[model samples]
Target: SDYSQEPPRHPSLLINSKVPFNAEPPRSALASSYVTPVDLFYKRNHGPIPVVDDIERYCVDICSLIGTPKKLYMRDVRMLPKYNVTATLQCAGNRRTAMSKTRKVRGVGWDVSAIGNAVWGGAKLADVLELIGIPKLTCSTQSGGKHVEFVSIDKCKEENGGPYKASIRLSQATNPEADVLLAYEMNGKPLNRDHGYPLRVIVPGVIGARSVKWLDSINIIAEECQGFFMQKDYKMFPPSVDWDNINWSTRRPQMDFPVQSVICSLEDVQSIKPGKVTISGYAVSGGGRGIERVDVSIDGGKTWLEASRSQKTGVPYIADHVSSDKWAWVLFEVTVDIPYSTEIVAKAVDSAANVQPENVQDIWNLRGILNTSWHRVQVRVGQ
Candidate 1:
């Protein structure tokens, strides 16, 4: 593939791989704000970014296993209702770097910044499906359409140079409450090529893999997508399983990510004076679950303190509140006095009462995906 026409990236971003352009913003920058800036958003690409030069002529083909195909142009989609949905998209392998320490894992070596929250504007997929006689909440069509597949223009090695693709259940796609969108705008501005210029699928409360970018088509199928990403990659495997005796079909592709929390104010190892210190970071959960609370531990896992959580400034965060964006992340902070060197840790609890695991090894998988373990950082105090 030709890699000459790549888009410009933020200089502060830590580039993991250059060929397919996988980079993430600094950890501190990620937790500094509720909504991540577009430039600072993590970029996870499998192949060269495909450029869409002609916006007027761009269209997305929609078809099913046993129905006539339909095409929706950019103008056609824009004519529908526009919604500003604030959602957080987190990679399944968000904290793969920490997991690698326990055991070797495959895929990108990301820290804690492979996630971002943004307000996306676009027509609901339910509305778009309605245009073609598909009713809302339809699980299966008369012709046996059960899943909705998204095909992208970007080609990747995982697909053997074929277009990237993924899918979700038809019930999820047809449910307006799901907030599944065919997004065209990000943060009120038209999406840049790096983030899918013409169109993209925004599957809120799900792993970023299912939100395919640079969209080319949508297909209603009888079963889940059989693409490389859906079938082979992104699926979590048991820690005991290795490449020699791995069975791809044994596990389903990861959908919604687990409850996650990370400490971004300090690095893995840092030196500071013996005094009061402020710790802050991000907490989020999948499947529209809200963050109920965040627990901070100053002396390793001995004792814990409750941290304040908020989405908007000056507003108290309540789980599942009308004002709260259920799909977005909440920033947590707390202050404590440190008289000696100690280890700091942070863990989160979701609205469902699901708490993050205490140890990485407990949830450690061969793929290093879904490392929602307690975030720990070593602190060295000075006189």
Candidate 2:
């Protein structure tokens, strides 16, 4: 009955804990202008939290290896037509504390706030897999299928193992730029219960344990996602492989999640009120290919400025104004003029040139998974 004591009302920034696989450190860690305030936006559970009683007896089982198994509910999926997505869910171990400082790797040691950027409304997992009929199999330009598997109702055991299941693929569950959702709501309302209330599965740009929460089943598979958190823990070895010369089948399960950025308004020991110090953060890139620019370095990367972005309404490439994937957050800013004894550092760079990995021991891996580097915070100027 330990639902992690269920109490994340809102405004969160915890980041890591292990009892039930916790994590939540990325609303940019709430600073740099803040806006991930959906109950602190970082809860990556793996087990024990399923207490769903009734969203009118919520269901959601739409299976398909070839087909058969339909189950709708939740008012037959909210009577369709409701697609609102303001993406960003990052957590391929979102910067696992820079790969646990290059070593000790296993799970849930996150430090980039596990990432968050809400606006996710609901309905549109390809219109509920074409209204649960599920048949859309085409793209055989010569048989080359590989992913599309999401199965979660939040069950677990492993460590002497038994239950736990997770999956993702089928070109990121049929990419329409990977909108892939079944979300009941978040940043709008409803899904609270440690965030898998009646439904969950947001898969934007992949990773975040394949975006599966209480969601029951969704398979379009060809392979990949055999479970065990996708073929034996989020694969990525090298840094001279550890955990017994790791070779978990030629390592590879971490679908798209590279260019990242963070530095959510200074705080290592915060205290700045001298002249000017207005740095900001939040940048993303993974499959969708949007975040075109976010470069801001304070004397650490030598010299880099250009950071003033924000524009996600109607998205027409910033539409003479709003264009960067609607549902917001590309936010950037800069304003420096420090003196009262310095020690500030910040870093970010996106838009596919994909910067960030400058440290973290050359992309440390052994299951710590893709920890986008450069996110230092240590300010002090006051007086």
Candidate 3:
């Protein structure tokens, strides 16, 4: 209960768990804005909230397998140039509840709202590398130091006496275009404890899990993070492979997620008035491949209509800074006649041509991760 230090959240968010708090905003309110308010943003944590006392003493260790290591204090990181990125962060299990409908899969049963967009301010990882030191990295199959690993400050039971950690390809961490950051602020304010006060890593275009919170150390290494999170979890497996016959190593850690969209409102089993009915929700693609289009169908997949995409606002500030990559998300709306009972379906196409699978069974896996299937809601359109 002392997790209250995380701050009181918007009462509208659906709380999936307490203690080590995890929750998501109401589906109807999730995509209502270009930048989700800090209070309404989704919260996902694996363990207790780590309190980093003495903000001045907070430090991030930068270790290099092939170069000298350095300790960058909070002030040191802040002294570096800051860049702002308006990006969306989604859990790998954003729509796990849908997948669970087909078969039981392990995870916090997240609805479709475990995602949000916000303006994050911090020093770019690439610029930090340049100002600090560049570790000699190699990509060879049998080589040394090809990855960048991160260790969190919060110890967790999930990792068995270890901190939650993750990693990315060395190039992904160092490439200026990748736009990774040591995010010190969320929106225009310093991060709240629940969101990694002091500092965290913002890995745009990747799953939220990759953006380690309470960032403690950055390490350049020859291998991917050896953390259990990177190895035993956050992976997908064929439905045929159950716990009895599963080989965790056979599957690669989930990196870029697939294209996905959802009809946030007008949910399943809801009764709607006949005549003109409106539908709206959010769509996003992973790996920096922006959503190209979102299609909604009222009578199942037989027919479709294009929803109006969220256009770049004419307003100034970093809103204008988001490039065509548009790593945030697209809020869409479409109004049409709903004369009878029908299944409302939504699917998104990413710039990479990745289309959401039409059914959860089509992409069903043992772990229920990456539930990017077309979102369908059966609603009765009477009265």
Candidate 4:
């Protein structure tokens, strides 16, 4: 693969892999702000980045199983009303390294920084589909199309060097409330090449894998795309299944992630002053579910205290608030008196009352995806 065309990245990012360019910001960087800066956002790539020199000529083809296919230029998509959707995208492999410690797991090794929230500016996909005659909230087309597949220009070994692709149900794609976007801008500025430059699909509240970058085309099909990431990869499996006996088809591609929380203010193991220590981190849930609560335990889950949650500075975060950004994450913090060496843990509950599993051992899978177990860190107090 040609690495010459890859764009420059932030030096502060901790590089997990250099070839395909996967890295994430430091844990402290994540807790420092609400909307993560674009450069600080985690980078996960399966293949070498694709370069698009002619933005004017770059177009995304929209094809249906039975209707005439249409190619939409940037100008054509831009004509629709622009909506800024704030959403969090997390890799399914986030915290895979921790899972690996429990048992050897396959995939990129990531800490808790594998997630980030940003404001995406783009044309609503629902509105864009209407231009092609697909009505809002459409579940099926006259041609029996039930899924919307997004194909990318970036190719990877997973697909035998073919462009990366994934799909979402057509019903979700057409729901205006889903906030799906063909985003061209991130954080109020034009998207950098590291992200999908000219355009990319942002499937809010879903795992980032389905949100394909570097737009190429869209397909309306009767079934989900049989892409490698969609079928053989990104599925949840039982701990009993190993590579030899594993059956990929037995499981479904994971969409909305489970409730998760992480303590970013401290590392996995750190020494700190013995007085009052401030604990800070992020808590988020998938499928537009709001974070109902974040619990922090200083003595290793023996007892817990509720942490204050907020999305914007000075504003209290209320779960499922009518005015809250349902697709974004909430920041939680609590200052506790730590007089001795102890273990700290954080866990979250979603609006639906879904709580994170207590242990990673229970949720461990061969692929190490969706390790939404309670986050724990050991800390030593200085005399």
**Residue-wise lDDT of candidate 2 within 155-272, one digit each (tens)?**
6765233334556655445545457778888878877877777778777766667777777766665666577777778777778888877777887677767777776776555777
Model 2, poorest ten-residue lDDT window?
313-322
Residue 1 lDDT in model 3? 23
> TM-score for all predictions?
0.99, 0.33, 0.94, 0.99
Ranking by TM-score: 4, 1, 3, 2
Model 2, position 322, has a per-residue lDDT of 38
Q: Give all candidates' CA lDDT scores.
A: 0.93, 0.66, 0.82, 0.93
Which residue runs does candidate 2 get wrong by more than 4 Å? Answer: 1-79, 89-122, 126-130, 133-166, 169-244, 249-261, 264-274, 283-337, 345-363, 366-368, 372-374, 377-383
Candidate 1 accuracy as lDDT: 0.93
Instruction: Give the alpha carbon lDDT tens digit for every residue of 218-317 in model 4.
Output: 9988999999999999999999998999999899899998899999999979999898999999999999999999999999999999999999877768
lDDT of 1 by residue, 302-350 (tens): 9999999999998788987487998999999999998999999999999
How would you order the candidates by lDDT, starting with the best?
4, 1, 3, 2
lDDT of 2 at 76: 69
lDDT by residue for model 3 over 28-85, one digit each (tens)? 7876777889998999998878888898777888887655788889888888889888
Q: Give the TM-score of candidate 3.
A: 0.94
